[model samples]
Structure formats: C-alpha cells, structure tokens
Target: MKISARSVAATLRDPGAWRIVLLHGEDAGLIRERATQAAQVITPDLDDPFRVAILGRDAHDRMVEECTALSLVGGRRVVWVREGRDGLTGLVKECLATRTDTLLIIEAPGLESRSKLRALLEKAKDCAVIACYPEEGRALEASIRQMLSEQGVQIDPDALSWFAERASPDRAATRAEVEKLFLFAGQGGRLTHEDVQACIGDAASVSLEDAAFAAMVGDRTGADLAIERAMNTDRMNPIGAARALLSHIHRLRRVRLAMDAGQGRAEAMSALWPQVFFKRTEAFGRAVAIWSADALMQAAVWTQQLELACKQTGSPDIVLCKRHVARLAAQARIMARQR
Candidate 1:
C-alpha cells in the first residue's frame, strides 16, 4: 500500500505484514538509504552472506532464485534489488503473491509517480511504496534539528537558520555536512552561526539565491557574477539555476496573492511554508510591495518556460538560462522605474 508521509519512518523501521517494499524518488541518496533501512529490519548486518542478497539491475534469474530460496541462516531473507526499473514489476508482483519469507526491497530512484512498478506497489495490498523525496523548508530544518539533538549537540536559532539555508537539497550531501558538523561540535557542544560557517560553509547555494535576487532587483552586473558562480559548480547546474529564478517568482507570487486577498504584510509572510530565508525577508518585503499579482504571475510563466527550454535534448542550458535571467532583469528595471 502507499505509505503516507507521516508513517514512512515507522513503516520502514518495521514493514509488518508487507511482503515487498518499494522506495522510489528523485533523490537517489534518500532512496538508497531508505532501502538499506528496510533491509536492516530483516538482517542486522546488510552484508550477511546467507540472509541478505544484493543484486544488480535486471538480474531476472538471480532475483527469482533468491526470492524463492530459503535462507541458510535460519531467518527471513532480504533481497535488495538496486537500480530497479519497470522490467521488475511482473517479478515483484509474482513474489508478492507467493508466501515467501523474504522481504523484497527495491530501489528505484528515478521512478515517476505514474511508473508502472511504483503504481503497482502503491496499490497492492501486500506491498509498501515509500516516496523518498528530499525534505525542504521547515521539514528539512526539523530534520537537521532532530539529527543534531540525537547527537547531543545544540544549535542556536541563528545558526540553524543559516545552515539550513545553505544545506544541500540531496540527502547524502546534507548528511555528510551534518556529520562534519557533529564532529566539529563534539558531544554536548553548542553550534553558533560562526561555528557552523567555519565547519560547513557552502557558498554555491548562497550564490544561487543571490543570483535570483539580483535578477529580480535589476542588478545586471551582480546577477551576471552571481549566476556564473552559482552554475557549473560541483553543487549546482544549469537546470538548478533556472529553478532558482522560478522559485523566486513563485514565492513572490504567493505573497502578492495573499496581499491582494487583503492580508497585512506580516500575515501574508506567515503563510510561507518553508518561511522566507530570515536574512532575505526584508528584501522580499520590498519586492512584494513593488510587484503586482499579475506581473508576478507573468514572471512565473516566463521562468517556467525558461526551465522547460533548458530541459530539451542538447540544449545550451547555461546560455539560455543567462539570457532568460537578463530578460527578467530588464523587466525588473522597467517595473521599478514605473513604481
């Protein structure tokens, strides 16, 4: 059955009565980690030769044999199928129908919502489908706080806000950064803004936000420099650069819509889910006041078009994104002058 967001962790920890567990999402790291967690429920050691079988992609014969065989180690077997695709859907369904002691764990990182395998698992009575999407905004911050608290480390509000803003969107990268912070903070140590900066300061995300803001405020030179720094880096890319502008437009559109509904500035801002980055709220306030709802909607449409154009085969993604951002900057200039 499809697992709800609230029940994902608990169900993963103990996938009771479910014969198969499918973890799929855009975040490959989160999918892999959750698959591992599901496997561990049956086998304490994932590498246990007899109890666990880790198979590569499209291993049809090996998968059937492993799923049907009884474990030599006297417990339920765990077969982890990595790099899963729709080809395994029929096999998974067959295994689910049989009364096997093996807990089938499939890692399908790139599966879309309508994927045949994902849909089968999500609708099946004896299966569990967990969407392993990356956490964002408050959910991500809460995750960070919970992880730190588990390690007996304290982080001040300012430090939490700062680090969360710069944290990677990928789970593995975020975990790596959090692990480093754990080491730096030590057991029972507190993390301040200065400490977090010294320990895990990534400038790529900051620069991405900067680039979006620069484009929105009509600062051509600043936008050009920030966009260059944000793209083609280890942590950022052309698709991501385009998304930053789209996100900026969407956020402003949301606030502007709220204001047009007769809400005060504070009331409208409070409706933001992953609230505006605390440091950017003042600039956001100024921007929200300057942009009319229709203008924001038009900007959002333009940004979305740019994103779609960047996705075409062999597209010159970077060049196209830069030109689109410049167009937005020019629009911003005219809008500001009119205001």
Candidate 2:
C-alpha cells in the first residue's frame, strides 16, 4: 500500500495491518520524522531494548534475527532499520516470507522507480510505502495551521502564508520555526504578518535564495558574495546549495518552455511557488529571458553531475561548487548578449 505525507499519521493509527513500513523520499528530515513516528506507534517505548531494535543496513543478520524474535516483555516488538538500501534486499525478503508480527520500519533515501528494494517493498502484501515528497503550497499551509492550532496559537491568514513560503523545505526546519512562533505568540495572542517576518523569516535562507537568483541572472560578484554568506554565515551545505540551484534551474526550464509556447511573461512568472518576491520580480523576468529552456535543462543536468561527483569523490566541495556557479553565470551572460 502507498501512504502519502498527509496520510502518514492516520496510517500509523492502525499500523498493524502492514508488516513492514517503508518511508522513503527526497526530504531526508521528513523521512526521519515519519520513521520515528511509525516506530513509536509500534513500540511506545522506543528505547526499550526488549521491545524495540534499531539496526543499520549493514546489520542485516541482526535485523533479520530481531524481526523474527519474540518480545521478552510479551508486548509489541519493533525492528527499526535506518539507511535502507540495495544491501537489505535479501534480508527484507527473508523476513517478509515469515509470519512474524514484529513491526518493521525502514527509512531510506529517495528510491528510483525501478529500484529493486523499492519494488520488493511495494509489491509485498504486508508492506506500506510512504513517499515523503517535499511539502509546499496547500499541503505546507495545512501543516503550519495544524501545528500552530494544536499549540493553541492562532495566526493571521496572511501571516500563515508568509511563514509557509519562507520556511525551509525540511520538515524539521518548518517545525522549529512554528515552535518558535508558538512560544512567541504565548497564550491566546494571535500572530501577524509582521511577526512572521520579524521572528521566523530566516536571513541565512534568504541569502542562499538570493545567491541562486544572482547566479541565474549572471551577477557574478553578487552571486559569489551571496554564496559566501550562505556558506560561512548561514552554514548551508555545498550539496544543499547545489540542489537549490538545480531546483531553480528546473523552474526556469518549465517557465521558459511555457513562454516559448507563447505564455506571457506575467503568466510564466505567476506560475512559480513562494511567488517571486516583489523586489526580485524585475530580475526574475530578466532571468527568464537570459536562458532558453534547453540551456536551463543542461544546467540542471550539469548541477546533478556536480553534486554526484562531490559526494562520490570527497572533493573540496565548496571550491567545485563555486566554480560551477561562476561558469553558470558566465554562460548566462553570453546567452543574454546573444539574445
């Protein structure tokens, strides 16, 4: 069975129907949170050695043993596995073939559609797969409202929207911001748009956001400084910075394609999320014209390759990332002049 982010809580309310639960997605923080929730739902005391077992992908033998073991305390048993990957395929198959009632919760990175492990987990009648895609727009709005409401804090509609738009894609970041607001609101006091800007709109994230925009618009010096501030001041990871740029390139690709198909500049710009801040609207319009859909697509591919190289080779990440940013900006400048 497939469970979405919106349904994770409800599904866990009655998790017994499935023998194994797979929470995998791009949002690593959300994946970890959901896995913890599932594990807690199965075994109330997650730290109880007799009732719960936590294992890594390399501990296949231990995981298999724990999955089939009976609880020493005669209650519920949970086998929680972290970093699920191709290596756990055999152990997962063996465990699922058995009739053990021990609840298994696996947390893995985003799996490809053809991934053997994902295929096995999804095909199993006893498994539940939860895909943790990044939350945005209405889903994000709902999450913010639900969390704040539960804390007995009410927020202005405009304030809620502003907060959601600025919150990091990571669920942990979003939760932290909301919790901060809850403490700030105190008692029955309501939060306003200004409160969100003053309290939760992160300057570091804004710097990174600006850096990405700067890179896309061919502002070499501005991009360099923004990247520097984001890394040194904000402490953003190089990999994360690359991913951010890739996401922007993707949005640019889509909007450029739409404009090529005759969509107006306003129409193309209006289609994006967190809608481009008013201050950056003009720069954004220039960016859309700076790169064609094909160029943006190539940039996306190159960004992904750079990310992989950084991860696999243990290279000096910031240096390589900065070089890539500079190249992208130069390319955009050339493209802009050609137009």
Candidate 3:
C-alpha cells in the first residue's frame, strides 16, 4: 500500500492490485509526471475523454462514479483526480471497497503525514501512496542527467554539474529549463561546458551562487559584485539571493559540523549532499576550512533573519540583503585572520 521511494518507479510500472494511487509532494512536476505515467499504464490516450476523467477538487463529488464506470473503448477507465484534498477521503475509500476496473490517480500536492486520505491509501491494500520531495545535490544532478538521457541529449560530465548548479530547486522550473536545453541541443546533440554556459547559464543564478560562496570566505569584493549583479541583472529578487545564500551557509555548516565530529575535512566535504558544484569546489573548500561550526551557525541565523526581513511589504529588500552580506563578509575576514 505504501510505496518506498526505492520502489516507487517499479511499482508505478506494474501496479497489479493498486486500483487507487495517490501521488503527494512539494514537487508538483514530479507528481504530475508520476500520475501521468501510472495512468498511461492503464489507458494510453489520456486525451481521450471516453477513457479518462479529469476531476478538480471542487468537482470531485462524482469521483466514485467515474472510478466505477467502464470506458467506451472497452478497456479499463482512468480517473484522474487533481488537486486532491481531505474532502475526497470517503469517495476514495468507497472506490476501494467497490472493486472497480478503473485505475484512479490522485494528485495531492500538499498532503500532510497525518492526512486521512494519505493514511487510508497507505493502509489499504488496494491503494498505493508515493511521496515526491525535491531532489538536491547528487540526486538533482542525476535527475538532470536522466532527463537529458531520455531525451537523447548528451552532455559532458562537467557541463552537467554546471547546468545542475543553475537548475532551479523546484521540479517544474527545472523541467522547463531542461526542456529549453532540449530544444537548444536538439536530438542526439552533445553539450559541453561552454555550450551549457551560453544557453543555460544566466547572470542572476550564477551571481547568486558567487555571492553566497564569496560571502562565506571573506571575498568582500567578489561578494559585493556578485550581489549587485544578481539583484540588478535579470530582475533577480533579493529574497531569492538571500535564500541561495542561506542554503550555501547551511551546506557549509553541515560539512563543518561533520569535521567537528572527527571526520577529516576532505572526507566531510566529499560526503556533502548535492556535492559542491565543480566550479565552486575550491571556494567552498576554502570557506569550510576558514569558518568554524559556531561561526557558520551564527551566519546561518543572520541569513535567515535577512530572508524574513525581505518578506516585509515594500521593504528595501536589496538593501537589507546587502547589509547581511557585508556583515557576513566582515565576519569571514575576522575568522580568516584568526586562522
């Protein structure tokens, strides 16, 4: 009933008795993709209204009927419920009890661990539940590689990491970027580092990464320039840069904490999740060695507060973000001297 992350793909390919499948997660694109895959297993033509019924949250009162109905084409029907919520628990339960030939796919984006529908699907032998969380680090890179591989697009290993660095954390955004790359590369075309930099890289995201890494390592000049480019070029929001900085700080903290726990710096860095982007590896290593765990923790707090300030309506978000970056750079300078 409950599909492990490892078994999700395999199960979706051959969901023997699972008449109702629930896909829930923060990754909306992943949910849509898995649901589509599962539905196609039962009915290939999702566009065919006779074999497929797409129901929104408000119009789901007839979900039970849709699930029990047979397709006009004489095969199994597919009932896809979009924007699922707790209101459909009873209907879903009813569908399970009725033993219908229709395969039900539910798209629930924000279902909580205690959600009744999620719970029911997990417990019911006739149902399957799959959770999709955003991928990060190596996993994110692997996902990009797989997407390209499936599209018959080839990318050099270094270029793949560079592209992954700019890839948005949100799956939908990442998918859009990947699709654009697909068009740029064409079928069976190869992508090199320069090719990806030219087509996929933009100033905002790259500058954001630059600002984050530079701020952590006492590169005040580098941090200043990168922050300005990120906020001014490509209409990058200060809040977004603040988040990127926060993420980098957290990553440094994780590695620093590991070093504090008796692991060598090289080993700890090697074990970083979503390993350091190839271009940033040296800078990241320097930042990790320069900042102690406590300093990194304090910097994280500063970055977090900066993010909260950026959310204030009509606030000078860019100014607020810059001040924090300056403070972090100053702290990094002091740490460097002491080291």
Clashes of 1: 1
lDDT of each: 0.83, 0.83, 0.86
Against the hidden reference, what TM-scores do the models get?
0.72, 0.64, 0.82
Pairs with backbone N, CA or C atoms under 3 Å apart (clashes), candidate 3: 137-274
Name the candidate, 1 or 2, with the larger TM-score value: 1
Which candidate's TM-score is highest? 3
Backbone clash total, candidate 2: 0
Per-residue lDDT of candidate 1, residues 1-339 (tens digit): 898999888898786557889888888878887887788878789878899898996475478778888987698988889989888877877787777878888888888777899888878887898888888877888989988998899998878878886777788888888889999999999999889978877566678788888778777788888888877579877777777788888988898888889999988997886567677788788778778889888988887888898899999988988888788778888888999
lDDT of 3 by residue, 179-259 (tens): 888899999999988788788788788888888888889989999998988888865898888788888988899999998
The TM-score, computed over Cα atoms with residue i paired to residue i, of candidate 2 is: 0.64
- Compared with the true structure, the alpha-carbon lDDT of candidate 1 equals 0.83
Is 1 or 3 the stronger prediction by TM-score? Answer: 3
